[model samples]
Target: MNKQAQAVVMLLFGGAIVRASLTDMYLRYVKESLRPFLIAAGLVLIAAAVMTLVHEVLRPKERAEEHDHGHDHGDGKPHREPWVAWLLILPVLGLLLVAPPALGSYAAGQSGTALSSQQISDYPPLPPGDPAKISVLDYASRAVFDKGVSLGDRTVRLTGFIASGPNGEPILARIILSCCAADGRPIKLGMSGNAPAGLANDSWVEVIGRYTDRTITDPVNEETIPYIEVETWTQIDPPKQQYE
Candidate 1:
């Protein structure tokens, strides 16, 4: 592509990145801690594009003529940019219009929890609260690997979307990202003891429960999933950050 065309594309892409980072939209694709770095990268791209554009406009006519002649063939048509260069605008348009929705139950169902065989060290007891809020990943890890010993008798609140089990039974689940959505996987917890019934998949909810000894086997991966003896549950809006 010509330098002028390249600079315009760069400016659009960089502006999209900066615009996304300025709001919570970026959290849908990456971790909250990555916001600053994303903003910095966007700024760098914008600076580079601006510099290229300035340099192109200020070039002496003699130098421009000489450079063009050096590479120009005896063709009748003007040079055209590569078709692939236009594809870069797709993401820019998407970013400007609407960010993609966060991963949901379908992704959770396709994924299997590896924490069943994992050896998580004893986590400290939950802090004070009748139903102390806990992350779905943390709760699942403690229940499966640590035998729920750290959870004690305290009830904890877990928030996640509903995912169906082998028998079409409802279960609580959340996606866990190692770095970004590309490496994300779901951690699951089976619901027992007065578990909510007839809830649709991906209906975000806050489940109140304590760890239980009961376990369920995941048919897809043949991994064991731990249970929570649910005291109660209530439907709610999805959280601002969907992944753990």
Candidate 2:
């Protein structure tokens, strides 16, 4: 691409980034904490594009002189870019039109629950609520690492998309991201007891259950997969942000 076309591509790319960040579409790809940086990057790209276009217009004589001399580019009529240069717009169009959906059960199934490799300390007990709401990561750690002692007798509320267990049993899962979806992995709790029947994979649900001693080895990752004795569950719309 010529300088002008490159500038236009930068402008479009920057606009897509800014729009996605402002509208929460960026949450699909990155953590919420990176919003300011994303916006700033978009602004810088926009600024740089504007500067390049302005310089190109204000210094037409320089461009003409280079074209006449052919510079070092043999027989160049203002040195055209390769056809591949236009491919950069594909990502811009994808982001501007529709950001991809958040990772779901498919991602969870491909990689089993992510657990810490180091030995863990005893965890504090669940809070005072009858069905205390807790994050999937917290509950997974307490269940698998602390061995459910911290969850003893506590009815807990957990929310995540349904994933298929090895034997076709449904499991509750949340995709955990340290920074962005690129680094995401699943943390899962197998459903047992009164787990609602016929809950399909990828269905979003909120489950009420108590931790069970039951666990199975994850076939994919060969990690200890923990279980929850579900007392009740309800299907719900997918959350705005799917990762923990």
Best candidate (score: lDDT): 2
Q: How many residue pairs of model 1 clash at the backbone?
A: 0
User: Where does candidate 2 clash, by residue pair?
Assistant: none
| Residue 230 in model 1: lDDT | 90
Worst lDDT window (10 residues) for model 1? 65-74
Query: Candidate 2 regions off by >4 Å?
Result: 62-79, 117-119
Model 1 residue runs over 4 Å out of place are: 62-79
Please give the TM-score that candidate 2 achieves against the real structure. Answer: 0.92
Which tens-of-lDDT digit does each residue in 91-171 have in candidate 1? 888888876888888887888875657574778878778889889878887887778788988899989889987667898
Report lDDT (Cα) of residue 226, candidate 1. 88
Q: How well does each candidate superpose onto the true structure, as a TM-score?
A: 0.90, 0.92
Q: Whole-model Cα lDDT per candidate?
A: 0.84, 0.85
Candidate number with greatest TM-score: 2
